[model samples]
Target: MTTILVTGGTGTLGRLVTERLRADGHEVRVLSRHSRPYAVDLRAGGAGLDAALAGVETVVHCASTPRGGDEQAARNLLAAAGRAGVDHLVYISIVGVDRVPFGYYRAKFAVERLVEESGLGWTVLRATQFHDLVVTLFEGLSKPPVMAVPAGVADQPVEVGEVAERLAELALSAPAGRVPDMAGPEVRPLDSLARAFLRATGRRRPVLRVPLLGKAYRAFREGGHLAPERAVGKVGFEEYLARRFGPDGGR
Candidate 1:
């Protein structure tokens, strides 16, 4: 059995990746800060990484920092993997992160560069925003019956499970430079999406428009977040809404 080590195994996508790998009869180990029945913190150096990484054929790095200064983390893990002689390293990133000028994007891009320079066989799977965006927009846009967001923003959020499955598949394959960037089937306008979320939650707030400055907003407003047609994931907006909001749309 191929032993696979997954960092951030406690997260949504990471947990799913670990669970799916185990289900497929692969020997899967989790990297986490918390101690669990199956957990190891990647941040801790060699002693922190357990025997799971020993004789491991692959390492799937799902752990990440949102803001800046993750180069050290990448260096540490890549260095560890390099020492371990791991066969492949798979990294999960965000779509349009290169195009967007956010701090987090900068950090992700930095990691991308690290992988390229690390000399270990590697693959990167850039994914679109998650369904969690729906819930996030609901909370961010609310202001006591009135909601506001980028006037002309657009998005194509995919399911987190889809991303997890893709990562699992990559872990089973030989190291490839970059995988197909995954996204949802439908390209959704932020305005309508926000309204749908509010309606789904049985909220009576009216969504308002607010334009953001610079390329950050323009990239989002101009369809920079949609996935290539060939790379579209199986799930779409309506299907996800129905699953989360129910037929009548309520808890």
Candidate 2:
């Protein structure tokens, strides 16, 4: 069994990927900023990183700072991996990052470039937004009776487990650059997704689709964040909500 080090192994997707990899009989080490067992901070690229990569054959880079500083972190990790002669580096990225104009998307795109040019054997899997993100968005906007959502925007929200499983599979295989994008089974409007969340959480709110004005929002409205041709995830938003909030939708 190969030893694998998973960056951002404590986060939502990272944790699931770590579990799946361990289940497959691989020795897994989780790298994070916090001082925990098997944790290494990617920002500190020194003895800590060297120790983390000592016997690791593969590196699954699931760590990302959407808010800021992702590119620097990626560079540090790539440099350390190259020095350690890592066999493969698998990067988990978002779908439509190249097309989207948001700052976070741009950062992710830059990191992708680093991995491609890092000279280490690498694989990049771009998946759509997760169900958890969708839920979190609605939860933040649930305070008012009239919930405002972006009109004309579409999303293909996939399950985190599906992404985790795919990451594990890719980490075990030969490094392939930029694999097929993974997306949810259905492509639904943002308004509809918000409505489903509201109904599931037993919230009595009128979801209003407001026309947003911004290049990023426009890109989203034009389906820049969608992968209609690559809808691989089996879990739909309704099914996901049903499982979480029950059949009656907690109403």
Candidate 3:
């Protein structure tokens, strides 16, 4: 069995990936800031990272912060992986990172570049936004009396479990650089998704579609973050909501 290390093993996607790898009979190590035995802070030069990488054949880099510090973490991981002689480095990225002008997307795109040129065997999978993220956004927007959503924006929210499954499969196979984009079954508008959340949560709120002025919003409106051609995901947002909130809108 291959020895694999998952960087954000406790996170939404990383946790599932780690479980999948271990279920497949591979030795899996979880490395997080607070995880035991290998609790190394990846953002700050990743001290003690060498110990974590020792004897590791593959690394699934799922540790990322939307606030900042992703590029630094990636650099530290790459350096450590190189020193440890890691066979493969798998990275997960967002689909619209290159097309969107958002700061977080820009940072993700930078990490993608680092993985490509790290001189190690690597694979990168760019997926659409996860359902959980969409739910979080809707939750935040729904807090106020009127939910204001960006006008004309659309998203294909893929299942995190499906993404984790794919990552596990990739980790076991040879490194194939930049595999096909994984997207949800439907390309849904933001307002529609917001409405779906309202229905699921049993909340009544007026949804406002405001046309925000920005390149990032423009890209979102133009569907830069969507992959209609690569809609390989089986689960849709409504089904996800049903599973998460139950039938009858979880009331």
Candidate 4:
């Protein structure tokens, strides 16, 4: 069995990836800021990172923060991986990092570059937004009496479990740089998704579409973040809601 290290191993996607790898008989190291044994902080130049990489053949980098510092974390990881002689480095990124002008997307794109030029065997998979993120967005939007959503914006929300499964598969295989994007089964409007959340939560609110200023908003409105052709994910938003909230809307 191969020895693999999964950064952010306690996170939503990382947790699943770690589980799959361990279940497949691979020795998995879970690295996080708070996780024991391998609790190294990547953002702080990843002290104690080299120890975690010892005998690790592969690495699945799932640790990222939308709040910032992702680029530094990636650089630290790449440096440590190179020093540890890691055979493969796998990264998960967003599909529209190139097309979208958002700050978080820009950081993700930067990390992608770092992985590519690190001189280590690497693979990168760009996926559409996860269902959990969409749910979080909707939960915040539904808080007010009138839910405000971006006008003409749509999201393709993929299942986190499916992404984790794919990452596990890639970790076991040879490094293939920049694979095809993974997207949800449908490209749905933001307002529609908000409505779905409202239905599932048994909440009634008027969904209002608001046109915001800036290039990033325009990019989103123009579908810069969608992957229509790569709609390979099996779970749709409605089905996800059904499973999460139950048939009776969890009422």
Candidate 5:
């Protein structure tokens, strides 16, 4: 059985990927900042990576730093992967990182470049935002009777499980540089998503649309993060909420 190392294995997508890989009978190693089995902090740059990379045929990088410093983490991992002579390196990134003008997206775009030029056989799969993230956004925006959201912001939120399965598939195959983007089955406006969440949670909050005034908002409005033509994922936002919160909505 080929051994695979999954960074950010404790995270939402990473956890699902690890489960899928193990279910397929591959020996999986989890890389994390916390002390655990096969843990390695990417921030330290190869301090504990050699042991994790040993006998590993592939590395799926799912860890990210949205606040900042993502490039350094990626570079550190790339260097270690090269030193280990790993055959394949797969990275999970957000869709529209190159087009979005946000700081986090810019950082991810840079990491994509690093992976491409790392001289190791590699594949990069960019997926739309996860459903769990949308829920978090809704929770954060909920402030009593009125919820304000940016106008024209839309998203194609895919299920974490689907994205994880795709990542696992790529890790098992030969490296294919920049594969087709994966996205949710449908694209919905930000306010619409919020409304769905409210309905699911049995909450009645009037969603107020606030005009967005930034390049990042404009890019999102223009469908930069959407992949309507390549909606490979089968789960939609409404379906996810129904399954997660139940049919009659939750308390």
Candidate 6:
């Protein structure tokens, strides 16, 4: 019954969130950089943004930049949403942004802080890296026969589909400030995940873990990226892989 605007609607997560909302009989409008039949970029602020948000009851913001440099734009989005009187703002963030030194994470953290201070009804869920991100990260980085990762790191990779469902559920509820974090069913070594990913893709590789020093590696190695008791996702690493590499993995 509500009209919601979904940022980054063309992306992996945004698409699923929009689909779920639509299925629930809610009106779904997606914002993106390139205008599509169902997309618009919310970054371009002004009356234009106000117009885009007109009559919108909720804004599920998933739009973000490549690994780094998008903090200001994120701020702009939040401000514009407030100006438009958006009822709820749901932001998807990464796990360990607090402890990690990664530039992208800093941006996520900044926006999360902004949302908290804005006094808007808001929910921010810090999630572990996506299982799909694992595959994407290692796709061309692995040296074919050798899987390489920053050494001593651990991660709990959850599925994007799971994230989508959670976002949909959160969109319908009052802002929980921050939702119970979500992650995969099991925790796995970074090297193991890389190896599993390569193997799932039918690629032969010996995964190599290269040591990295920094808050990023330190936090990751110290288990900054797992949500064991908070996992609400249904797909496990193996299950995700089967969808991508099992005999029927090829669609």
Runs in model 4 lying further than 4 Å from the true structure:
none
Residue 196 of model 5 has an lDDT of: 94
Cα lDDT for residue 91, model 3?
Answer: 97
TM-score of each: 0.91, 0.97, 0.98, 0.98, 0.97, 0.92
Better of 2 and 6 by TM-score: 2
The worst-scoring run of ten residues by lDDT in candidate 4 lies at 39-48
Candidate 3 segments exceeding 4 Å error:
none
Please give, for residues 150-240, the per-residue lDDT of candidate 3 as tens digits.
9988889999999999999999999999999999999988999999999999999999999889888888888888899999999999999
Alpha-carbon lDDT of model 2: 0.91
Query: How far does residue 60 in candidate 1 sit from its true spot (Å)?
Result: 1.0
C-alpha lDDT of candidate 6 relative to the true structure: 0.81
**lDDT of candidate 1 over 54-137, digit per residue (tens):** 787898898876644466677778888887899899999888878777778778888999998899999999998888766676
Best by lDDT: 4
lDDT value for model 5: 0.91
Count of clashes, each model: 1, 0, 0, 0, 0, 5
For residues 1-251, write the lDDT of model 4, one tens digit per residue: 99999999999999999999999999999999999999999998655899999889999999999999999999889999999999999999999999999999999999999999999999999999999899998888888899999999999999999999999999999999999999999999999999999999899999999989999999998999999999999999999999999989998
Per-residue CA lDDT of model 5 for 18-53, tens digit only, reads 999999999999998874866777877765888888
**Per-residue lDDT tens digits of candidate 6, residues 1-251?**
99998988878999999999999999998887775543444555666566778888898988888655467666777788778889899999988788777777878888889889886899998888887888778887775566678888777888898899999999999888987788877888878877777666777777777887776778778886667787766788877888787864343
Relative to the unseen true structure, what is the C-alpha lDDT of residue 150 in candidate 6, on a scale of 0 to 100? 85
Candidate 3, residue 194: CA error in Å?
1.0
Q: Least accurate stretch of 10 residues (summed lDDT) in model 5?
A: 34-43
lDDT of 3 at 11: 94
lDDT of 5 at 38: 67
Q: To one decimal, what is the Cα RMSD in angstroms of model 2 from the true structure?
A: 1.2
